[model samples]
Target: MTSATETETETETATDAASRPAPPLIYDGHCHVASTDFIPRQFMEDVAATVHRALEAQGAAPPLARLVDAYAAQHQDHDADALVAEMDAAGVARSVLMVPDFSLRMDCPLTPEEMARRHHEIRLRHPGRFWVFIGADPRHGADGIAAFEHAVTQYGFEGLKLYPPCGYSPSDERLFPYYEICAERGLPVFVHTGPTVRSLDYEPAHPMLIDRAAREFPGVEFILGHGAVTYFDVCADLALHRPNVHLDLGGFAGAALPDGWPTHLNRAFRLGLNHKMIFGTDWPLNRMTGGLTRLVREVTEGTEVFAGVRRREQALILSGNLARLLTRKGNE
Candidate 1:
């Protein structure tokens, strides 16, 4: 019963819709839930203690317990509603939520399985808005391994996040089993590759510690989190030489020096490793400095961190590279 003119119009509209290019991807490669439930109480206490000692040294002392309470108060957004609103404002299409297992190393209420379930629930609540990277310390033994495998096989978690500062080398034999799962599943591995709070063991997180794993597990992609701001040259070198190794700009959220971030990033780009660079803001951790909008602007607009980067390359740094990594091999 449709008119010929109406049919023609509809056909034209469909063609136009199909022909239009997809929107550019703006992805946040790293972030976390700003909730105390996910972060361990012991970790909070350590952070509070570290800050207190630092302040006392500088002679700007505040009561220790008060500071601890303040730190606790900063993490109220359990559901990430505020984070989603901010991401929308910043034009971030998706984010990777990193849930590191602190149950073993710290006094945490939630076990590894419970934490993984919480992240899976968050992913379901938001659908395509978030991807999850789960962490399971090798010290958790068989139970931890089972929980990690379950998250990937049943819950559809995307990647693995390892915190070496929790006291284990990236090259540890215990982590090999996890690496095998990542290789088989085509999941990337993100390792904490630099200094953290004074509480954790810093020596274990040295950049070179990942070299052995990078050489051994060529099938799995290894991303050095906080690579930009910590051991920049060494991390860039690893990404430059190793086919499977890459770097994420997680700690650049608070680049204070005028030329600090740009200089370090340009060095990597100059080494022809632009594609190896993934844009990440350790959100909520750096939320005190600025919002996601500011972080996005610093990398995408004007003559700043991404000044000389072409549109195509900029696309890779912003989201294309991550999109490629996130694609499961079998699906492709």
Candidate 2:
């Protein structure tokens, strides 16, 4: 048996050891609170099925039923206060939220104004902990552009998020005017670059399309969402070639880190582009402790892919670099 003083000392020693190599200050660069009303039910179903299969294939316990339950819960709640509380618990200093463009396609009944309003409310409620980006669909044509302007100017939204899976290329004429709006306003755009679930036009989601737009509108900054995962080679090429493009690590650690993540990241870091990256938990979609916590552990200790990276470099990946790029004295 140990005395109370000894127990206290031992606990303090453990705490000190844990604090020695602390995780970086995180600014979660992508978080979505897809409305319980609008986001596709099918999307959740597909996700549950995919993870269930992945678990069974790996012989993981119980075949992802708990994951399915979590997905169901995520789809039903658009609660901002809860999200902020979760952020506090997870040690995330701030999170950037975005309204997605899937509403029109999935037959969800809501207008751009409604979505923007909801996201803006979250921002208002948790001012420092949250910032928001509104989505614009070029297919809605001039009406879409009008709504996007309203979102930025009316709601004080800081950015735009586009889904190419909605069937418009970055270079399409329909989207050019929206890009112009972003350029003149100095707002960064987060464009989805990976394969979409049951996508309508896969080619439009290609990362190369962004290269064209980046060249054409040099004033506008673009963020390649998911970092184009499998198409990372082209994505890296774009980042290397263009000063206006950046990548966010939102979906890469999808449903658990897929094999080769370290290799993919190693190549990117080797190419000397770590500063162009941002950390995003892709929260709710990814549970904080399981995914984000695991990532912090793997990367900090140097996995096969992240071997021997310095602490400051890992800090940069986690949030420091993102702070420099985002709005309103973020780097400070």
Best by TM-score: 1
Candidate with the greatest lDDT versus the true structure: 1
User: What is the lDDT of every predicted structure here?
Assistant: 0.84, 0.74
TM-score for model 2? Answer: 0.82
- lDDT per residue for candidate 2 within 35-148, as digits (tens), equals 565466666666667767867888884645677667767665575766676677667788888778776567655666787887777777777787777888888877889999
lDDT of 2: 0.74
Candidate 1 C-alpha error for residue 155, in Å: 0.5
User: What residue runs in model 1 are displaced by over 4 Å at the alpha carbon?
Assistant: 1-24, 49-60, 255-258, 330-332
